[model samples]
Target: MAEGRLQRELNRRNPFETPEQEAVLNLLRTGDLILNRFGRLFGEHNITDSQYNVLKILRDEGQPMPSLGIAGRMVQVVPAITGLIDRLEAKELVVRRRCVQDRRVVYVEITPLGTKLLAELDQPVLALHKQMVGKLSQPEVKQLSRLLEKAREVFSQ
Candidate 1:
């Protein structure tokens, strides 16, 4: 069999040290490529991927969430959440409020403006998802997702 597309694309004359190494590298590369495309889309809307993710989390929760809870769900470091919230607050996309019961706790909520922006993005985001994996048959996509989930199970052990 010929070298994989990634090996060829990287111009690597030597084979990967192991199948595990190759699989990990492929996963990272694919993730990076997809993220880059998403970044471009978000850029056009004047937000970063992190910001979009934060908003999405809040929207999905259907209620104000603690700042730490939102940060825990994001790929970003906990400290970085402050800056992200700051930027979102500046845009009036999100607002931060002190938890009435606990002054030390801050809650973040998506504003009407943020919800509106997310609504505007719904169609484009869906289109991009289709564009990304539309070639895969539904079953194939399901299989891929299952396989990835199974692979992640190792981390739980």
Candidate 2:
């Protein structure tokens, strides 16, 4: 039998123990490759991807949103969300507002600066996504999405 792409890349002396193991490794490798590309791009803009995501969620809401509410939409943990907000606040891209009646509830709103930053990033981000997926045909892209979604379903079980 011919060696597979991953076996050649890993320079493995033996085949993967199972097809599931091979698939998992491939997914992880691909995720790391894609993440590195985006990390560099976001770093150039002086913002991490996590920070950018916070701004995007705020901007999309078009109003102040409770901090926890924003965090719910993100992959970040609740505690980490507070840190993300703090950094953004330091950058003057967002402001934290305490609810008038509920001191414990903090709301995060994107500042004009935040909105501007996102606007500036819109084209470059889109271009990067296109460049990343450029090799895949439309149908291939759809298939890949479906496969990823199906993989995610496994976690729900």
Candidate 3:
């Protein structure tokens, strides 16, 4: 049998038990490698991937967002959002305010500094994305996105 790239990379002595397992492992390995690249980029700017994500979400919303709302959109658990917010707040990247009507509720708004940081990162991030998948043609990229969206739908249901 011909050696697959992943098999050679892993230096596996035996073949995968099944194609399904092999595909899943390949997807995970690819994601981890890509994430590591992004991690280094984010590190240079003194923020983790999660922090960048939070700031980006707030920027996209165009208004102050509730803590729970931000938490809902994060990959991390809800409890983790608090610590993430605290760090961003300490850096003056975000400001937290109590809700006017519901004091129990906290709203977070990105600072101009945060917006500036994201703006600076925009080009590098785009370049990184292109670098990661530049080998794939436009059509293949679109198809891959469609396939990923379909795969995610299973979890939504």
Candidate 4:
């Protein structure tokens, strides 16, 4: 049957690869699937994942932050932050204020409208998290979180 043939092809692998390589490939594949699901959820709210992240960071800081500061917190380049802020400003979700003391510095702040939007998203966001990993017991969740943090420690060097 076609299904059987397809399964056989999928299971086929290079004989030269070691177990570590296969494990890493599997991890990448799983991460992609998880991120894709979150992307679709964020898209339904008329904002990309990156835009949501920017709004969240502003909310967390509870004050306008310099453009460079936001970029530094994120893994994005300084130039890309300008365009991102531009789009958010155009949406009226955020506003930009130039530093009076230093004209070269710009601060970005989330608007009241942005806060309301994020509030509305709160329930759905929690629901999505529950859908993703709610089945795990509390201990399992803690263990998984620890493992993920440890994995990131590898790159801290």
lDDT value, candidate 1, whole model: 0.93
Give the per-residue lDDT digits (tens) of candidate 1, residues 42-99: 9999999999999999999999999899988876778999999999999999999999
Per-residue C-alpha lDDT of model 2 across residues 1-157, encoded as one tens digit per residue: 6777999998999998888998999889988888889999999999998998898898889999998899899887799998899999999999998999999999898998999999999999999888888999999989999999988997899
What's the true lDDT of residue 144 in model 3? 86
Pairs clashing within candidate 2: none
Evaluated at residue 35, the lDDT of candidate 3 is 96
lDDT of each: 0.93, 0.91, 0.94, 0.84
What TM-score number comes out for model 3?
0.95
How close is each model in CA RMSD to the real structure?
1.1, 1.2, 1.2, 4.2
* Clash count for each candidate, listed in order shown: 0, 0, 0, 0
Candidate 2 TM-score, C-alpha based: 0.94
Candidate 4's displacement at residue 25, Å, is: 2.3
Ordered list by lDDT, greatest first: 3, 1, 2, 4
Any idea how many clashes model 2 has? 0
For residues 20-122, write the lDDT of model 3, one tens digit per residue: 7887899899999999999999999999999999999999999999999998887888899999999999999999999999999999999999999999999
| TM, every model | 0.95, 0.94, 0.95, 0.84
Better of 3 and 4 by TM-score: 3
For model 1, the superposed segments whose C-alpha errors exceed 4 Å read: none
